[model samples]
Target: MRSMTLGLLALTLASACGRNTPRPAARADAPPCHCSHDASAPMAANQPLPDTSVFQMGVPWTDQSGRAFDLASLAGSPTVVLMFYGTCQSTCPLLVRDVKRVEAALSPAARARTRFLLVTFDPSTDTPERLSALAAEDHLDLSRWTLLRGADHDIRTFATVLGVQFSRVGPGEYTHSNLITLLDPQGVVATQLEGLQQPVEEFARRIEGYTR
Candidate 1:
């Protein structure tokens, strides 16, 4: 009779143990076990950028308005690009004037379609405040103009791609080749004018062609 009671007690204990044993916790690195769709999650839907475009460099830049963006953000517009230091006394001002001349030559419709980008080699000095001051002094139309500043390495890489050569000739001065580059909507170099002497009308026509 005692052996029968012992057997029944063992069976009851075994059943209780089986029911009470907890499952192991999941590992920290393991992926989530989701059972339902996430409606608020963002979908991966971006197309790959072209390999040859400069925007593919993924360099970060800050503009005169203290807004941060990558070069790819300017991808869809026909850009008039040039590199200059804000404190430059010689060719830099001439370059700005030449770009303005091109802007002046554009019709209102064409001007609205074009974007002017000025990247500074002297990022250390050309902070957003300084760029804003310069823009105000030049009466730059902020609606269509963007002044950019990035790291020194990024500046060098940008100049190299545009075939612009620049060096710090003295304190607060830079000696850079006066070249203006026009980029198509795809960020491909459509045309490059080597000096400030190029006719503004020709440059304007090139930009207009791209807009059309």
Candidate 2:
């Protein structure tokens, strides 16, 4: 059972879309993407990543503090990532709480080296100011948590890299999968958790292993 769970979650990290994935409207200006995934073998910490690393993308981003950010800069630490918009009323809030639980489970040493990254799907609405407000409202520690927005095309590319499916269904409305990915120090996925209201103890233990 444990192996099966890990295998499925690993496939998600390798960018395997679910069978019922929604067909989002295509963007004419979106860049060509050649996402790759190899879940045939387990990844080790601190190794150099392949061309398929999520950190390989060079898309520019602006953080909640209105500072320029790079995906590659998160390379040297364990990162917990969630793709979400600030104004989401339903699942996004629950997802945020889930991640907060994961944070609370970590020891001070582990938490200090770990970072939480939130990327918004609705970049236009989730501007730097709004993201900052959301973080403050959530009472997230700025030093360890980051909220960022990028161009739509870049956001799509990044989401594809992580196998996070999302589509704008209505005005200020988006339907997306609830995914939490753990990236190793070298920016390769170490594990992933999907869905909501699930126990995060296993996820927390896996992260603690990487810190040791």
Candidate 3:
């Protein structure tokens, strides 16, 4: 009878030990828990740019408003690009007018998707204040227009990339080729018009095509 009682007591202790033991923790390789969308969450990586994009160059630029930006910042929109000095007498005014004409020809929807970039070859004289004054004088639509200036070396490099030739003709004067280039959203050269008074109908059409 004592052996039987001892056996029962041992069985009871084993049960108590089993009840006190904890379960194994969750698996380390378990899937992550789902959560609702959070505006403050970290952003995903940006999409890769095309190989032939001009934004591939790491050139820095400053706008008429004194804001600093790079070519990459202008991505995701069709751009009308031209190089001009702020103080030119002969062809610069005509180039600006041609750009204005192109802008006017764009449909409202296309206009929204289009942007204009004017880079100054004479950065020494075309300070932000001077560019701002020129923009105001020409009644340029500041909302969609950007005037840029950079270091002389960078300006030369950019001109070379665009195949634009320029040489200093006089003090504060430059003789540059009259070329206006249209870049797609990816910064690829889509079309180039080579004259101060070239018809903008085709250029507008190309812009509209890209925007669509």
Ranking by lDDT: 3, 2, 1
| C-alpha lDDT values of all predictions | 0.77, 0.80, 0.81
What is the number of residue pairs that collide in model 2? 0
Q: Write the per-residue lDDT of candidate 1 for residues 40-109, one digit (tens) a residue.
A: 2322235354455666788889999889967776666668998999988888888988888889999888
Number of the top candidate by lDDT?
3
TM-score: model 1 vs. ground truth: 0.75
The TM-score that candidate 3 achieves is: 0.77
Residue-by-residue lDDT tens digits, candidate 3, 1-212:
54354535665665567646533332342212221132113222374556766767889999998999788877777789999998898899999999999999999998987889999999899999999999999998888999999999999999987778898877898988899988766676767888769999988987777666
Candidate scoring better on lDDT of 1 and 2: 2
Candidate 3 Cα RMSD after full superposition onto the native fold (Å): 26.5
**What TM-score, over all chains together, does every model reach?**
0.75, 0.77, 0.77
Score residue 14 of candidate 2 by CA lDDT: 52
Q: Summing lDDT over every window of 10 consecutive residues in candidate 2, give the lowest-scoring window.
A: 31-40
Error of 1 at 193 (Å): 1.2
* Candidate 2 residue-wise lDDT at 31: 27
Residue 118, model 1: lDDT of: 91
